[model samples]
Structure formats: C-alpha cells, structure tokens
Target: MKYVEKAPHVDPVRMRHITDEALLAELGVTSIAEARPWRRPDPAWDGPATIEEADALIGAEVDFLDKGRGRSRLYGFHYLRWMTPLVHAYRETGDARYAAEWDRLFRQWYGTRDQVEGDWPGLDVIWYSLGVWARSMHVTRAMAELADEPALSDECWAMMMKTVLGGARWSAEEHDEFRHGNWQFVCAAELLHVATLFPELPEAPRWAEIGRARVLEHLELDVRADGGHHERSPGYHGMVLDAVHRVLALDPSFAEHPRVRAMHSWFASLVTSGGWIPHLQDSGVVWPAGALRRGAELGVRPEPGSHLLDASGYAIFRAGHLHTVINYGPYVGHELEPHSHHAALDFVLSGWGVPLAWEAGGPPSYDDPGYYDWYQATRGHNTILVPGEEYTEDRKAGLDLFHAGQHVDVFAGHHHGYSARHDRRIVFVRDEPSYWLVTDSIDADAVWQVHGLAPWKPHGSGYVTKNLLVVPLEAPDEVLHGNGPARIPDPATGTAEYGEIHSLGLRRADGRFTVALVPFTDDPPAVHLATVPPLASPQETSVPDHLRVAIGGIVDTVSASTWARADVREGWAADG
Candidate 1:
C-alpha cells in the first residue's frame, strides 16, 4: 500500500518495526482503514477570503503556479502552498474540481523529475536548500495532510511516498538558518510532521529525535530571553509560532514546556484591544494567525496589562480603546540582517475604532522597487528622519527608559542615524484615554513624519486621519515635498498585509517640536501651545525650557527636557 527506502545515515540500532496500530493511534485513529480524525490541512492558516481564493484556484483563468506577485522570484507558488487551498476547499465543500486540480498539478510536477541527487536534484533546479525545503513540505502535505487521500494514479501515490522518504533523508542534512532566521521553525515542523505521519520508516524515529532537538535548541537560541523572535518581525514571530503549533498539535509532547509557554505569551503581549497585532519590523497591521488564536485556547499567556519588555525594548500599552506598541534597541541580528526596518521610536497607534498610524511597506516581494528606497528607509516610518540617512545598516535606535502606568505612561528613545542625535519621548495620558504628548529633540535639521492610515490632507492647522488629529505644537508652515508616498503590501492571499498607508512629513529647521495626538469625531477639538522660552540665560546654555499644551480643553505644563508635566517629572532619557 505504501513504499519507502531506508536512508543510509539512520542508525540501524535505533530502528524499530513500529506497528500499524500505534502509528494510527498517534493520529487518534484505531486503524489505517478509518480516516484520520486529527490531521488538519494547515494549522494557524488565516486568509480573509480563503474559500473564495481557493475556489478561484480551480478556475482555468487563475494559474496556481504563477510565481511571485509580479517579480517572478518567489518559489512559494511553484509547488508549495498550492496544495493548502485545494485541500482546504475540498474539505469545505467536497468539491471534485479541487481534487481534479490537485491531480493535474501533481502529475505536472512529478513529470519534471527524472532522477535524484542528494534526494532532490531535479526538484530544486531553481535553488538548492530552499527548493528542497519547499518540496519537502509540499510532498508531505500531499501525502500526509490529506488523509482522505486525493484520488491519484497508484503510480503517483507510490512515487510520493518515495519522495517523502528521500526528502526526510536529504533535509536531515542541509543548509539550515536556525541561528539567523525563521527557517529552523519551518524545518522542525516539516521533520516532525514527517516522523508522526510515517513512523514505520527506519528514519522516522531519528527524524523525530532530530526535530525535537531542533525545537528545543530553537527555544533557547532563536527566541530571545524577552520572548521575542530574534528576527524582529511580529508577522514572522506568528509564523514561527504557527509552525511550532501545527507540528506539536499532532504529537502533544512539548506544548507545556516553559519556553514554549513563554513564546506564546510574548506574541499575546502584542495583541491590541482591537484583536490585531501592530506592525513591527517588516510586518504589517495584521490579525493574529489561527495558531495564535489556538494557543489562547491552551491558556499560555501571562497576566494582562500595559508593560515593558526591557530586553527587546518593546513597550506595549493596551487599554479598552487605546493601543500602542513601540520598539527600540540594539539591532537584533546585524550579521545577516533579518527582514527589518530602520524605524526607531516609530509606533503603531489605534484608538476609538480606527487605526491611527501603522508600519509601512509590509513584506513586499523582496525585489520590489521601493523595498529599500522607501519601505526600509528611516523616513518611511512615523519618526523623525534626518536627510542623509538612507536605509543603511547603521540606522539604529535604543530605548533609554520606560515607565508603565494605568492612567499615564512614558517612553524615551534615541538614535543617531545621520551623525546627529535625535531624542524622542512620548507621554501617554489616559485621563481621556486617547491622547499623546510627543516631544522630539534633535541637534540637526530633520523631516518628522507620520505614517497615517489615510493620506494626509491639509486640515486647518495640522494633519488628520479618519479619526485622529496630529497637532504639532511647534508648527511648520508647510509639509515638504520630499516625503509622502503610499506603501504597498505583499499580495499574498492569506496575509492581511495592512494597506496603502501614506507617509506624511514636515520639515523642521531646528528639529525641536512637541506634538499632540488626539482622537475625536464630529466637531474639531481646540488645541493650544504656549512656549515658555528659557529666561534667555546667557550663562547657562542648557537651561530647561517649559511649555503649556492644551488639547480638546485638557491642558498641562510640559517640560522640554523632561518630556512630561513639570510636576510629574521623575525620569528623563538623559538619566542614563
């Protein structure tokens, strides 16, 4: 009924003739004759229009093999991820078209292969390790995830099992990115899934051992002590989480490990009141993956509240209506930079019922035109940008201090990207629960920006989004033409990669400004700024200046140096 060759490297002493009943029991089934009750197609998969997209794949007009959104460089569309939709659609409606299409694609791919080199010579023609990894998952899903077994020619099914064993052997030794990227999590998922699906193979036991060991090592090496993924992208963080969840859900061995639980907690910490994770690093404004929702059912998250992760420099504040996540620190991995941005003190803000500000140029086709010029540039973020600072490796930021509170909170960060110092402090006041006092102190001229959910229009005295008003206390006469372009997200079907958010900018000569962000609807709110210029101290050049800012009738005296109400000053960025 099935076929597999013993790989050469598998230890013969470790081999065990596992019975058919035990393998079926691993999937919670009594016999191989009965259908597997627990083998899901894709765990943590979340596409807004999954059925519609899957159904479209059955149409002749839509080619499931169209690589890349436009760049033709992506290998994901080739043989990988195409099976998920067909299998998903088939399960949803018992559609014969979905099955028929899978048969068509499978034969087409199988026909292209003539021989094997290190298990996959013709399979990975375009690339080496990446092709092997992708094909391994694809073949595994075709044979394993679809337990109902798409009706295929007997020859095709047997050929698939042979490939499965070959893939296990080849992948057991290959170029691994465990220390640098998300590939390790993906590899671990694939290896474990292989072991669980086909333990009768001689290599299955060793595959399980290798997969578990990698997972354990990943918990220590790839995930930071603060629980954030070393790559620094929350979207990727969720991806790695989903990989771990799906494979372990099949086995149930390491679900309760302390590190695993902590990983779940870290992802949950970024969830906004609106149920979406704020864009961070290369991620976009996105909803949590199905796996994250599944993890919540397992009850692994820590206590709820506003708090700070000092190691990763993420100060997450979540309230009933207001949500914000700010990140800054030494670069996570600069050797082989993970998908990241040059954003420091840049944050995503959502209040009332709409998104205020968000990250820009979400994971684009890596070769997209604006991939470096705009998406990864410092000016692309909602932070101060010096003119000469392009999206280089040196563009960096680090948190100076963080203070969390129920009614008020504070965050201060600094970056010297263009050989000039820029310090930013944000004070969150919850009296009204939808306001912020942001002060930026820079030693050089800079272009301050805001990546708004909507394109910025000339709204009276300052910029305004759908429901948020950005009122700069120290106003610039006009916004410079150098900034303000729309950032497009990757067109992957399952991912909600934010939208075409616009980057708005204003040039400042002295690079010193205090801004008030207030969320309101209907009538516009009144805002006032009274600058108390330092009593012209010729003797003391570093005298602290103070000011009064009034937003929608609420007023407070903010100090330029301390970045908070004069009476409320306890810590400053300079304290270190």
Candidate 2:
C-alpha cells in the first residue's frame, strides 16, 4: 500500500484540544488488557454479555433505534468509537498493551463477513462508523510507528478503507448535505479529515471538493449573518461551532473564512459572564468550559449589538441590572429539525447575573412520547398559554413592532399558538430602577381561556395579585436558584441547590390581560407598578404603556395598599 503524505498543517495536538472528552470518558478503561472486555454493559448487547463473552455477536438482531433498546446499543457504538482515546493513551504511555488491544478490537469488530457486512441499521450507526473511521485515520496518519507495524498496519489500512467507502456511499445516498443541518456537518467534516489524511486514494479529490462544499453550504444556511444559528438553540449553535473548528484544524484555508469567524463570534456572544448560555431547546444551561477555552484560543470575538439575533429570532436586552432574552424568531422546528420549543415571542428575565423568570423544563428525551405533545407545547414556556391549544411550528411568529431608545425598550409580536391571533407587547422603562409591563391581546370569534405565567423563584415576601406578581430579590442566591430549562444545580440527585424553578401565574377569560412585574430590595429606589387607564383621546405624551414609579414621593395613586387582588390567587409562588 502506498503511504499518503499528511497535510503539513494537520497536527494532532490541535485536534486533541477540540476532541469530545465527555464522550471519550463514557468508555474509559482502567487497563489496556481490559479494552476488549470493556464493551458497554447495555442489555441491548444481545441480552447482555459477561466479560468472558465480550466479543460475542450480541447485537446482530437488535434494532438500535428502538427507544427501549436504543441507549444500550448506543453505548455499544460508543465502545466502537473508542479508537480515539485508545490511540491517545497509547501515544502518551508508550505501552504495547494499547496497540495489542486496538488490533484485537479492530479484528473483533471488522474481521469477518458477518461482522463487517451486516446491516448498518440506522443513520446513527453510520454516523458512529464515520467517527470511528476519522479517529482511526488520525491515529494511523499521525503515528507512523503505528502505521509501520507490518501486519497490524495492513489490517488498519483495510479497515480504514472499508469504513470510509461505506460511510461516503451512505452519506451520498441517505443525506442531502445542503438540507440536513447538524448531521451533514459531522459527515462532511469527517470526509474532509479523511481526504486530508490520504491524498493517494482514487476518491480523495472528490471527497475534498464535496466535503468542502457541503460544510460551507451548512455555514451559509444554518448560521445567520447576525452570528446566530437558525435553529435558535444555544446548545446546537455550540455543537456546530465545535465541528467547524475541528475541520479547520485539518484545512487551514477555512480558518479565516468570514462565515467560520462569524459562527465562533456568535458562540462567544451567547455566553454569559457566569459562563452559561440560557438553555434553549436541547441546549444545556452551562456551555462546556473546554469548548469555551478553545473558542477563546481561536480568537472568536463576541460581536456587539443590542443583543439582537434578528435572523435567528431572539434578543437579549440589557439595562442597569437586567438581562432579558425575548424569543421573536421564526418557527425553529421543521420537518428535519424539531429540537426547538414552541416558545416564540416568549421572554426570559435575569437580574444582576441571576435568572428571575424562565421555563420549568420539558420532557428529558426527544424519543419520549410526551416530547411533542407536552414539553414542546405552549404551556411549557414562560408565555401566555391558551387552554386546550398547542403551538405548532407551521405558523411563524413575526415581530410587528420594535423600538430601542434611550428611554424605553419595547417589542411586540404575534404568534398563532392558538386559534386566535395572540398579539403580545412588552415594554421596559429606564426609570431609576426598571420593571416590565406586558400586555397580551387576543382576537377571535369565540371566548378563550387565557393566562400568563411568570415562573420565578420565591426569593422573598411575594404574592400573586390579580394582574401582578411580585418577587423581592433580597439576595443573589434566590436569583441563582431560578435558572431553568436546564437545571442549574441539577434536579435528579437533589445534591445541587440551583435547579429548582417555581411558577407565578395569572388567569383571566377576557380578551386582554395586562400584567406587571414589580421588584423589591432592602435599599431605596424600590420598583413599583400601576395600570394606566385607557386615555379618552390620543395625545403626544411619552407616558409608558403602564407605570413604573420609584417609591419615594409623589401622589402614589397606584399604591400596594390599593391593589385589587387583596385576596391572593391560588398556587401563588409566595404562598407555596
């Protein structure tokens, strides 16, 4: 076999920095001798395999995509892709144990007609196979010692060719690189890596052209000009950025591409000072520290704007001590992408680096039956929920009004989450201290059951009045505990303190509901609110939609003493 020369710029040290450590840790082995016996202990592994029976063909008949059987089979696939760390460990330790185990595992997985020729089953299997091939290529090309092992080297070459050809063929037939978002990114990136590793192959140049074109196409479509991904999920945005970074490591030509730079910039902008991005869709609350470090090393600049990602449909507005995210983008979920939520035009609020109001989280898994029905429903968000109606992604949410000025910040949009056209208007004043006033108007023939939810942490003495919910921010810990969608401290073990999120709600059958959020502190300049009555005539006064009067002096007409809902509502956060 003719040994192809590697790209001079392709260095393993650079690739190792961006590698998926969480995934590698999933298949950790205490010793190289145990590598063959370290198959993931999944019941789907042909009804479970003891250590002695590790190499047995237990997964021959299992449908790996079936939910009940998926996790187990998925774990087995992780073991197959463990070539990444195995090679890394071998290089670091200079141990023959690693090489012998790698040879054994490769033979067990690929030596026979039944093992290699069996049905590849699903896209996930193909995806995992591509991952294995890429890692194996990296090992062979970078470590000449591994490639010079005569017999083992020949076997590696055969296996690499088999997997790459199969993956390329499957990719061309099964996926349209231009259409599938994240999947194509992975496939194309791997193809490019393979092409760079082996220039002597007949299919090398074609792979290079197609892979480069496909990846650039994804960057054009999925990444918006404003430096946000079209999916509008912070997690996926990070995932795509990492993929691009890996490919750029192999081909330095893409390093300075405008789209590539913009993607990284978007990632840097999404992160908060606390090192977390608001969990949207499948994204977790905290961005990976390693990815952030790599992004910084790559010189990803956070673009300056009003925190508005117009193309992707979100704006993070900041004021004195407030950081608010408003979702006013198109339907993020589509036929090929359904990972986003029915959270159009909804707003998430945080104050002084602490979350104040957010969602309570949805179904844990995508394949879970309740995912589309319940968690993705409108009721799962911190927005108005119409009874018996679910928001569908078919109807887009468009922003009808927007203004950001020195005195006020306002946004209005309509969503077809129900039979009625739900028009919501939100405005924040730049008073000494700030508060938000939200007005929701519905237009329909039939009477509707409407309510607004403000899921906040019960930090201090607070209550849910008829048209208002007040939560006092006495300390920062209360605000920290309020971060949601992705649990902060995590909810499962109860060991962490920041994951719990509580709800504050209002219910009214009327077509219009005006609500106010008032903030209280131990110091002066306390936040207060009042409902401004409809004027008898239109005038040129710049009076806000509702009133936010700092409580020190003046008539105080809309005082807390005169609140209409003296009788607190049921299930109020403070009462709970």
Candidate 3:
C-alpha cells in the first residue's frame, strides 16, 4: 500500500455496520427512509443531523471553557462520531445533498476553530484544542469520498495542509516529556496518520518519521517490564492500548514488536472471569473485550491459565471457570501525578462471568467531593484501612512467594501504607472445590488502630466481630470524606459512581487473619467464619513512643494473636 494515499485500516464491512448503527442513533430513525429528516439541501443545517425530538442537538461554540478538561461545549462536534454517517450516506447513496451538508459542516467548524484558538488561556489549554483539532482533521481527511465537488475538495485539501504543518511544528517543538505517555501517544498517532495519508505534502516524510519514532519510544516506556502501563491506572492502560492498536492497524509492521505483544498479553490476562478488569489505580469498571479480541488477532495471547506480572506486581489465579486477581506491588510513580491508589496487596475475586467482589466502581466526576473521599481512598478498595490515616504513594513492597505450578498458586508481599507494615500472603489451591486463602499481617505500634476493609456490593452478607466492623457501605453524605491539601485538575468525569456497599472491617494491629474465598458462577456462596488457634507465637514486635502516646493507654502486654478463617461454600461439585 502507498503510504501517502493510505487511509485508516478500517474494514469496509465492519465500518458499514458500525456506520449504519451510528446513523440510526444520531437521526433517531428506524429505517433508511427516515434517515434524512432535514431538507436535502438545508444550507443552515451545517452541522451533523440531530434527532428531531432532541432539543439540544449540538452546541454552537467550539471552545466553551466551562465543560472542563478535554470536553468541549460542542461534544458531538468534537467527537464527530456523526462523520461515519455523513460520509457513508454521501458515498453509498450518491447523494449530492449529503455532500453539500458535509461542506457546510466543514466550513462552520473551520470558522469556529480559528476563533477558539485566539481565545485559549495558555499552553495547558492548548492540549484540549490540540486534541479537538487532531480528531476533526483526522475525520475530514480520512473521508476522501465525501468531498465530491471541486470547490469542497480544494478547501478540504487546504485545511489538510494547514493541519499537517501546524501539527508537525507542534510535534517538533514540544519536548517528549512535556506531553508524555498518553499525550505523546495521541499527538504522535495523529501526526503519523496525517503524514501517511498525505505524503505528497512537503513536510509529510519528516513528520511521519518523527511521529513513528516518538510513538515507538513511548510505547516501550509507558508499558512497564510487567506489561502494565506506568500510569498504574488500568483505565488509562486500556485507553493507551487502544490508541496503540489504531497505530498498529495503520502500519502492521509494529504488530510483531515484543513490547507491543506484551502489552496485549497483559490486557488479555488482566480481565477477571466476570468480564471485568481489575479496577487498579484510576482504571474504570468497564471491560475492553474488543481490545482483547484485537490483541488475540495480533498474536498477543493470554497465559495458558494463570500467571503473574512480577514487575507490575499483579498475580492472576484461574481454576476451572473461576478467576481471581491479587495486587502486591510497589507504587508506580510517574513524572506527573501517577494516579496510584493506596490499595496495595489488595485482591478481587470473580467466577465465570460474575464479579464476586469488585474494586470500588469508577470515579464518576473529578469535581465531586466523593472522588477523593471514597472512590480514590483506601476504604474504596478490598484491602486494609487505617482508621484515621490515609495511604500515600510510597513504593514499599516486596514479593515473598510466586509459584503457579503443581495445582497451587502462592503469592505474598508487604506494603507500607498508613505508616504501617503490611505483610499479605495468598494461596490458591486448585483441588476439588477450588478455593483461595488470604492472609494479612498488619504490624503497627499500639499508637495506630488498623481496620481490614473487605468491600463488596451491598447485596452481599457478612458478620461483624469485636475485631471487625461489618456494615453496609454508606455514601459520602453518611461517611466522613477527607481530601489532601494539594489539589490537581482532573479532566473528565470517570465512569465510577458511588453506591451503598457491604464493608467487612477488622480493627486489630499486629495481627494475622485468614479468609477463604470461593467464587460461584451464579448465586452468592455461603460463608462460615471460624477461629483458628495460633500454631506458634506471633512474630517479634515493639511499640514506638508515638504509638504509645497516640493510644493514650497501656499497650496490651499479651501481644495476642487472633486468626479468623471464613470458609466459602460454592456448588463446585465436579471439582470437589
């Protein structure tokens, strides 16, 4: 394929289906006959067609600052999902009217885009505009079939050249670290697509070369040795991976790259049997099944059954139809805000395609107080929480055991969050009625009071003991919400919304607790809690002056050790 004339590697058949669906949604029409609701040549209707019933189809302004982050007042115009329908209608149906509408929309956008730039505040705001420009220009250039008229074709070409020059200049001037990781990927991929699509332009070759190099370099750096993105957020990991996939689609040579395949492999293995990826860091709850399928097509396959990502400190244990994920790794620190969470050595369980215990749902909006209070807090995860303390981004983690052979998988690590040393061990036995055991040892001076926070949907049931606080998770309105003094600007509202939950809390310092989790494909399993006597004296411990002062009482001399074992009963008859 000639690089200059090449377009996005979209499959015509699949694109047609996707376009058809988009058209139906945009126009609110049931059939092709109803697709063109507006007059065939409504010159005033310059933007994409909107449903007749919709009052607010598209916003007029190109850059309304109030929407926040990458969002624009004109959401549809920025996303331009409506392009497929416009291009498809014009190309397949031979409708000059559709072409005219496309022309009008292009001119309207071009005019607004120019005005918005003069109004931008600073260099930071430029990123949002850059993203908008990239997406708009990409759509316009790729849909070559829509520009049928000579005048429209010439105007489109002029915009293309302008876009290429401006984008290329930005790429050359901007340091790699300035717009690093996801930003680098976005800019490079856009430039690559533009330069490749229009190589006839004088700057095409240079821009394309630069774009290729930057993308490949970041692709290596952004993804860690364990195959996870350095951002440490599973949400951004999938997003960045999807962007890489698009680049690979345009140029297939990169598919064979080891780093690329490792990325795909990581994603494929990251998903729980419940069809949900671990909500690690700032990642969302939605699964990326399509990305996984594409990864497989690109020869990036998951481990045979179970495996561990040592560098990223994630371990996956799979037995029969059940799947579980354990995180016992260091905090991944990025140059900027890493979005790392305090749920170190936390684990999530699932069976078949149902989530038994979920990570906190995605953060709904960055502006909401609940974002920091609950969604991003240690209490939001399935891990131990210090009563009056918070987790910090300290890389205090070490692996104790990692063996996934002989029908047994064991993984253990220690992390220091809340100023306490936490040693956690997980043992997955793949015997009849497969079950997993979680052992947590929190060592802290008497000054601090620790609580084990086992979170699940409100529907689940559990008991609360003197060492445990079992109650339905309350909303931010009900629970105390605290945030750090320093605040950062978050762009988009994440998908996670807070809801009531069932929280299993343990308030015991310098203690070890064991719980067996057995996931069921259908209904919630039956759980029984039992006390296990210590086989040996607990490990040596000491109290600090600060802890003694904080506790304001005599430190318990007995150094008592209490272990509770919860046995789960799931109907895995065949396995048993």
Output the number of the TM-score-best candidate.
Answer: 1
Q: lDDT of model 2 at residue 106?
A: 61
Candidate 1 on 1-576: residue-level lDDT in tens?
011344233222111122355433322323233323224656544443367767676644434334334432444444356556876676678766776777666666555543312222243432333455566665655554344544544345434545565666655664233545676666676777777766655667888887777777787887777777777777777777777777667767677666677777787787665566666776665566554666677776664777876666788777777878776755555332357777777877876535677656455555567767677767667888777656345556777767666556777777766577778888777556257777777777777777776666666577776667777765774585333334322224423533566666777777776777777766457666666664465223222367666765566665533445434543344423
lDDT agreement of model 1 with the native: 0.62
**Clash count in backbone of candidate 1:** 1
Candidate 3 C-alpha error for residue 107, in Å: 4.6
**All models, RMSD in angstroms:** 6.3, 11.7, 12.2
Evaluate all candidate structures by whole-model CA lDDT and list the values in order. 0.62, 0.50, 0.51
Q: What TM-score number comes out for model 2?
A: 0.67
TM-score of each: 0.82, 0.67, 0.68
Name the 10 consecutive residues with the lowest summed lDDT in model 3. Answer: 543-552
Q: Candidate 3 — what's its lDDT?
A: 0.51
Best by lDDT: 1
lDDT of 3 at 349: 63
Model 3 error, position 573 (Å): 30
Write the residue-wise lDDT of candidate 3 on 1-576 in tens digits.
Answer: 121122222222111112255433432323322111111221112234433312222233334323443322233244444444555555546756555555555556554553343222443323342453345344543345543343344355334334444555566446334345565666676667656654544556776787788778777776788677766667777766765765775688988778788887787777765455756776666466676777778777677677888777788888776677787776665443456666677776665554455556445444446666666677767776666675777847777666675545667677777676877666665654455555566654212112222333322333322223222211111222222211111113312233344444444444545545544434444444232232343353221111100001211111111111224211211100
Error of 2 at 514 (Å): 2.9
